[model samples]
Target: MGMTTDPFSLLGLEPTAALDPAVVRQVFQERAAAVHPDHGADAADRAERTALFASLNEAQRCLSSTPQRLRVLLQVRYPELAASHAGAVMDGAFMELFGAVGAALEKAKAVQSRRAGVVSALARAMLMADETMAADAVMGALGAVNDAMGALERALPALDETMRSGEACGPQLKAAAARAGFLEKWQAQLRAAHAGAVG
Candidate 1:
């Protein structure tokens, strides 16, 4: 999609982070259908139709996720926010938690690799036992990640209020975006552990 059209505009919604998923999905489906090249557009217009359809799909995907929606909203509303906070350092306490999560993820990843490499039933059982032994640490890491995510979620209402009031919110939005990034990455790591255990 062109930088000229932000995700909200592409999806025909007001530019806000707290969008209703149902509304976004409905708008996305409508827009997707309208721009789809298969809908009897002239053959010569296929390129334009394809681009529009792709843009609509991209917009829908971005706005459908909370982190992505916030990031895009910040990008559209405060272009400088991303540049200023792209590398904002997490506070000491958060960093400690993040480090712990990282260590646990590494352990989980190693276990998953070992599990994948072993073909013998006995070896698989042993790996499962090892994973079971490490369950507490993995769970603790997941708990920390969830707590951090909760903190991020609590900050959203204040950010939204600041936006609604037409106040300067570049710092708040940027911080939120950064925290969202951290949470998303941590959650993915935790998901890998869960997937390994289930598989």
Candidate 2:
């Protein structure tokens, strides 16, 4: 409850900031199928299974976007991030990181539209950048992720609007999930890099 230390790991996934909906859904189905109450009719581990199921779901929702995922991570590591949202602005370093993440997300989206495997590539870029990026650069990348996350957050409405307009929602949702995976990977890399260097 107190930030759920290592929330990503709670679901048996790696410590990452963003998550691939496909993978998340896949894993959830696999795990949930095994642990769901219906499957646990004769088990004493029902409570634990339920907890795991819930954790998996929480992980999916929190890691669904860069911003939401970042917020959860920051809540665990930098509690102050939540505080600064009221009137005060994020630190300059954070602002820069947010911008970089947003731009990367846009690129990732384009790559997704073309059916390119952009998640690994985008993640590789972030991972490679991690080796030498300054704190400011790291924060900038995070900021960009936040921007991408903003785009993701707006998707629910977009999906609704698209449906109301008679456009297909399938392609757009797929693309958004793809880009979201990239953002998630980038955030994980950022956290990993930061922890490696400074933690």
Candidate 3:
């Protein structure tokens, strides 16, 4: 199998969004060991094993993340539906969460800006209170984002059950993938902001 091979098939997993990341990692490790280039007998065999190992690495990377796994599963199972839902709008709850994260990030930026403008140690010390407040806000916002991500992860089992039951859940899978993508992005942003606020 090459890079374009189905990731679930490459990783020996059933195509479902409810996969546990730890299980995927374990499976990938086992498969990678079997195909490892170090076990190759000759030059040509080493090259072939190297390629296969690379493909396995790609598969593991895609399947180890909830968003990427969902996208891969959707594209493999419902290409047309996945393409159609590419630009689907996030629902109201995500919008609200996005707003909160945005606000926290802005506050952190403001604190960073003020801290940078202060050249004197006394001035910088004076700004510590505001920085602490900003840090607290960022931590709170990060907690909210984490909670939202957890909720999405908790819903994956039900989505898997729906698919297993032979119902059409491409739309739901697409929506969850979209939300996971946003949450992952926001989580990174919030983490960076928190670091800046505290640092």
Candidate 4:
């Protein structure tokens, strides 16, 4: 399939910002099984099945997350709007979470640096309390990120309703997608920091 192929169409779903992840998974599983290369009757058939299977997997990946799904929905339905808002600045709410995550990551890096400088076992042992505190801070930041993500997911259904009503929700959808992108990035960073602190 081409890059322009609509993932929702590939998965036999309507193009919408709100989709239940479980439903997407179930549909992908069923569709993938039917086109699986292993069941192909000949080499040419198998090759075709392989390509289709890959497209199905790509569709599943796109629809599996709220942010990605919203992006795809915008690209497919309102390409102009998506392009226009591509460089829009993040709103105040996301910036606050960004600050918290940044601080936690910095603390974790400091703890890791201190741990690295210690040569003696006793010195390393002495740094355990500091490492624990850093880990705790990382975990707290991760919780805040997750909470923000959850709130975004919860708002999707209403966003979908607005779109269905023929209202202009392009800006709202773009902002939500941008915020989700930030939260997703922060979650990864925080997890890595937590691992460094506690590993």
TM per candidate comes to 0.82, 0.38, 0.95, 0.94
Error of 3 at 159 (Å): 0.5
Q: State the lDDT of candidate 2 residue by residue for 1-199, as single tens digits.
A: 3335455565566533345667766766676777676555556677767766777677666665544554554454345544453433344754565567555445443333333333577764654433334444555666667676676765556554655575644434444444555567778876654444332
Top-down TM-score ranking: 3, 4, 1, 2
Best by TM-score: 3
Q: Which stretches of candidate 1 lie over 4 Å from their true place?
A: 1-3, 113-124, 197-199
Residue 3 accuracy (lDDT) in model 3? 70
List the global CA lDDT of all models. 0.78, 0.55, 0.89, 0.89
Model 3 agreement with the true structure over 87-155: per-residue lDDT tens digits: 757888888988888889999999999988899999989999989989998889899989998999999
Model 1 agreement with the true structure over 1-199: per-residue lDDT tens digits? 3545888988879887677778998998988888788874588688788888888888888887778888898888888766563576678988898888878777777787787789999888778777874565778888888888777776677777888898988777776777787788888878778667546
* Candidate 4 per-residue lDDT over residues 38-134, each given as its tens digit: 9999999999999999999999988997778888888887889977835647778778878889899999999999988899999989999999999
Point out the higher-scoring one by lDDT: 1 or 3.
3
Shift of residue 89 alpha carbon in model 3, Å: 3.3
Error of 3 at 188 (Å): 0.8
